[model samples]
Target: MAVRGAGRVRSEVLSKKLYCASSTPPPHARHFADNQCQSMESFFTRFKNVLVLVAILLAQTIGLAVQVRRPVESGAPDSSKVTLIRYWAVSVVSPFERFFHGIGYTFRHGWSNYVDLRHTRQENHDLQDQIARLRLEQASFAEDAMQGHRLQAMLDFQQHYVSTTVAAQVIGTSGNDLSRVIYIDKGSKDGLKTDQAVITPDGIVGKIRDVFPHTSQVLLINDQTSGAGVLLATTRIRAILRGSTTGQILINNLTPDNRIKPGEQVLSSGGDQVYPRGLAVGTIESIKIDPDHQPYTLIQLRPAANLNQLEEVLVITGTQTTLSAQAQKDLAAGVTTAEAQAAAKQIADQQAAEAAARSAAQIVADRLPSIHEGEDEAKPGTAAPPATTPPVSVVPKPLPTIHSDRYSPGATPSASDLKPGAAEPPNEKDLN
Candidate 1:
């Protein structure tokens, strides 16, 4: 399975790559290196001289406070000593002295405020980045929650149908971590056998190629050798969906004039041992008629499960045969839990179950509109989706009209390189 890497961080530094010779100097000069310091010192000294005079006068007040705090002799007791202490400590130039201190304090506070403002601006920039990251995370979590609903649909297959099913999340994928495999949470211990079908909420993914005690690797439907019987949902035209080496499907035997068109749904026809029926393969991208004169028309299928970005998938324990969700509900109507007395409770429970299912279905319908062939806008003037598009299902898109042997995870094996006039397996989308 491929290991996804975190996106690389972009450098915020505005580097213009200014290359210069040794003789070249910098654009900006140092502020304090000039005679500014001399001027400041001269100013400070002048201010200090004024402060010294103020200090000489104000010493009386400090002197009195000090005397009170610690009684002291006036050195040489003069007649003006007590009077000087009284006048200076109480009123002599006290207002001017306060004014001086206030100016000095204001300067200090102003410098500190500027520093604080710079720091706050940097912090705000960081906080903006944090908010953007948090929004991305919130969207991811919300998507995961919405995906929980889709999983509920996959899990619904486990419930309505009487098949032993185990759930698993796709922990990793391939390419960066290059391999044509998907790593799943389930393993041999969880009844995940080698070659067991792995799928998702939408439909079939692939089979377990290898299994460990707690983890298993899935051979994606995009695998060259992977093959499953598939039919168009709209046309019900049966065709063999096989994996391309390029990780798409070479839907062969589909004529250009056939009912299948781009965007038509594909599902497992369920003939071979690979996957069960009704497992959605993907939508048709284009219809083609190869001039090579093959028995059937050529079809290119996009996988239902996104094989490359295998973030999550489900592993089917046994074969699943579904008429439809609606069909199953209709079928269960006659089957009562008990006899006449318990009938009311059984009906209530069934109704409640149906209501819950409808509600769950409603959430999807509200978020996802049905897509028909080649229509751009979901409806006429529906708001464009938010900048962030949801993670596409592990599904791959259709291929162009080339020799359909494409979408392979790795190099095409020598045996799969069939030339013209050679009988090859009909569009091995996932030829098991």
Candidate 2:
């Protein structure tokens, strides 16, 4: 009975321990379990994005492996064979990529078209300015070219005239309408003297009236005090060119018998000892009856040189004296004589050579065979006619001699002078 009581007590004790363990835990054990659950939740929160990235990487890696293992056929990919992973990836990423690309493209377009156009406009304006400057330079160059052409013409005229000239620039002018005078930047120091002719490439301008040390005064042909001896080029009528009180150039001492007409050219006659002969003076402008002198005709002339617009001129100191002195020197040195003799000798030699050639040609023509009538139609078997030879003692007839006094150079010979049987008369070229 005591053992049974003890067993009941132990069983009741074990039941109490089981109930405590199962239902209400100890404080230390419960605290450790709650801490483990909190730590697990914190770990998940800290690495949530990392875990998601790892999962995506794993999925892509599996897709790549599948793609690599699959056998690819040649040519276009079959839509049926395309994997869902690539399709989904392209679909999900395409919209954002396209959106960003469009934004970038629009931004670049605006920058290139709208923003950069400001600089382009400035460059265009600068280019226009440069073109304008170039056009101005071109105009300046054209003006220089025209000046060069004028200078060239003057140089050619100087060479043709073959006169000693001093180039002078027109510096000033006498401001009186009646006294048309100009001052030149040349003087006695430059070999300019009174009465020296002044001229341009176009025609004669005037003559020097007074000479200073470094400058000279010129009296233009239109001045009232100026006078020049002029002659009509076609009619050869001599007249005096004098300026009127009104600064009009008039031809005086022209009689009514003188048939002067407009447009006739006038040239210097060198009578006044101021201008050289053959220099262009003026042209006849009009012809009318003189009211003051009814017996004489009034003649108006237009000066050749542009007197009002004179810029450059040539002063002829002395062309005739210089040329005459040169000619005298050449003659004294026997240069002219030698040149004439040499030219004559050359001409004589050429004539002699031509005569010899003519003589030889005549002998050759006489030696050639001559055909008689019916020679072409003669049969081959028939004997040819015998050629008759003149007697060797029969001398040819002699030609008549021409008298030196009667033979005029370059005159054609008369038929009466040529004998019928004599050789042909000497040609005019042979006589020369």
Task: Please provide, for model 2 over 255-357, each residue's C-alpha lDDT reduced to its tens digit, 9 standing for 90 to 100.
Answer: 7755667999999887777788779988889898898988788899888988888878999875732235553453334443445556888999999998788
Clashing pairs in 2: none
TM-score of each model, in listed order: 0.37, 0.39
Best by TM-score: 2
lDDT of each: 0.60, 0.70
Candidate 2 has a TM-score of 0.39
CA shift at 308, candidate 2, in angstroms?
A: 1.0
For model 2, the stretches where C-alpha displacement exceeds 4 angstroms are 1-162, 321-432
Residue 229 displacement (Å), model 1: 0.7
